[model samples]
Target: MGAPPQPRAPSRRVKLFSAWFWLYLVASLTVFWFAVVIPWLVITPFDRRRRFSHWYAYTWANHLHAVSPFWTIVVEHAERMRADQAYVLVCNHQSSGDILTMFSLRKQFRWVAKRGLFALPFLGWMMAMAGYVGIKRGDKRSRERMMAKCRRQLELGNTIAMFPEGTRSTTRHMRPFKRGAFVLACESNKPVLPVIMVGTHETLPRDSWVFTLERKIYPVLRVLEPIEPAAHDHDPERLADAVCERMTAAIEQLRAEIEARGGLEVRPPQ
Candidate 1:
């Protein structure tokens, strides 16, 4: 064979003006935030220990995914997640959809996200009301505050989820791991749960506002075996490296599985 045929580009018209797509997103945000999130915020105290808001947010997120006709999320080994155990859940970031796909885990965790995400309109407001930690990158004071908040959350028997890459990978490749998440794990003596998310970039690539509806996107969320903090002897750098290696391997395995299936439509086992 001389050359393989390349994939066709998505229709620009459809990307820009998909009536159902836009309507679904708009209605999801407006109705859910106004009808559910706002009411919960009003009824609950900001510092309440019971995470009624997070549960509502999780349900809303699942509903949003369920309404998307072109997308399906399959989470594997989700039963490995324990309700009683607190963990530093570290995941590789690929696209904005990674955040949405994570809710499939259905595990209660406080997200450690960038400060800017905390400034968005409805989403950010909901995150704040749900008590997620926000850090201003490169700001020492902000980092300190974030770490303090994470430790406190752990003390309260809550898991903390962080994107160890610190930013989305434009090419869906693994980037250098950041130490914040590992440090939190080592300091708190919690297990580091490595979660690999694949196909998110295909669903919605970085810097692209439009959803790629050319093909059905089946995103996979795999929760690998957790690494105990004691194994790293409280060294965040080493723990980060180990977790990164495991995640990279897990991504490769996911890709191989997809290839074996000969398509991206294979749903991971329930």
Candidate 2:
């Protein structure tokens, strides 16, 4: 199955540490939010694109992970992200924490996320404030509107980031990518940047509210070379498949490297 063993019972020490960690996280996060509220309100009117809001959100995420000893994030090939290019970023879905790890790339893109995420407490509100694009799941009208918005943002010279899987996978195996993001890239004539993430589902599952207490989580982020316009023949379906195939190969290659380095061992592929 290429999936890690299911969660085991937390020891008493783990339970205690998790409890303490959550409290510390919640309290510190409140401060992180409030600290930026004034700056956010001040910048919203002057900054037409809301780029500051985007930076604020990701900076908060990066700092949160930075302070937590439980997490060690390694972002590879970040320099591949250039400031001059506005790309339609195509990323895989691994876990909610993928936001923290992926967004740490700080690529200056507006996120395209599902509607329910905006309903989440501070995190969702941050997405709204950061001008992220949201689509209602299974709602055709909502999707159409979202596409229109993304197109406008692209024209305005803003990069767009999307998780084409639509939802997180339950295992190491990735879900099928939806076509919307690739369609947008073709329509806009922008490059498709594949962001591959590892080590999320094994630690932070979509259904779990509490993070693992005993295990230290290391999320690896790899940014491959952009799929240039010349590569896909301006076809969304072909582009989607090309991207999916490239990412799948890279994921397996990354797992092998991790194994070779004696890094945190991922479950072997079936």
Candidate 3:
């Protein structure tokens, strides 16, 4: 024994299945992007665009469920998400795959995405149509504009989804929560809903653009009990810490299960 025995390669059937799945996802996204998305963009008037945008988002998300391979998405404590309520929803930043988790909710919420995403052609236009508020982290003026828009959106009964870590982490360890989300909750006096997204990073890590598949590796979205902001408001840093701690614990527990299955360890991005 020169060395430990090597593992067998994936079977032909497995390889073929993966190929078909990739093709299906590409074809589906293309049709939806052009046929559905383009028409909605063209037909819907500027002031009334949100309705069409929401419909488009819902349809696209449902399409993902139809085309996804190898893994299922599980939502826990979903009752926490109420259609009648307006709250500030915050989650950890992981892979772009996390978009599936958010879209899977099928609820109408505006995203607070980085300005860069807003620069994409059709995607940027669609996001704006959907009433999404893009934030430019580089400029103070842009930061002020984003804060104002978020507050206004909340007032208008729209929920805002934000990633408190600012950027996706390469590792499982949670990054220091930023103060913007907490500040919004406090200033707006809206309830903050903490969401824990598990396993998305492993499903599609930051450095890799290729989609990977694994058994029982489905992603999980756990809606933790909401954190209601006091009328007087607490220190923004403290509120941010409390939210960060709760989500970090949930993610770690999930990581343990994957590790026990001999999956690769997800390290926090530096």
The best candidate by TM-score is 1
Off by over 4 Å in 2: 213-217, 265-270
How many clashes (backbone atoms < 3 Å, residues ≥3 apart in a chain or on different chains) does model 2 have? 0
Show where candidate 3 strays beyond 4 Å: 1-30, 33-52, 214-216, 254-270
How would you order the candidates by lDDT, starting with the best?
A: 1, 2, 3
TM-score of each: 0.90, 0.89, 0.80
- lDDT per residue as tens, model 2, 99-215: 777867866989888788888877677788888989998899999999999998888788899888888887677789899999999989999999898776655666764566465
Please list the Cα RMSD from the true structure of every candidate, rounded to 1 decimal place.
3.3, 3.5, 6.5
Most accurate candidate by lDDT: 1
Candidates by TM-score, descending order: 1, 2, 3
* Model 1 RMSD in angstroms: 3.3
Candidate 1 vs candidate 3: which has greater TM-score?
1
Give me the displacement of residue 189 in model 3, in angstroms: 0.5
Clashing pairs in 1: none
lDDT (Cα atoms) of all candidates against the true structure: 0.82, 0.80, 0.73
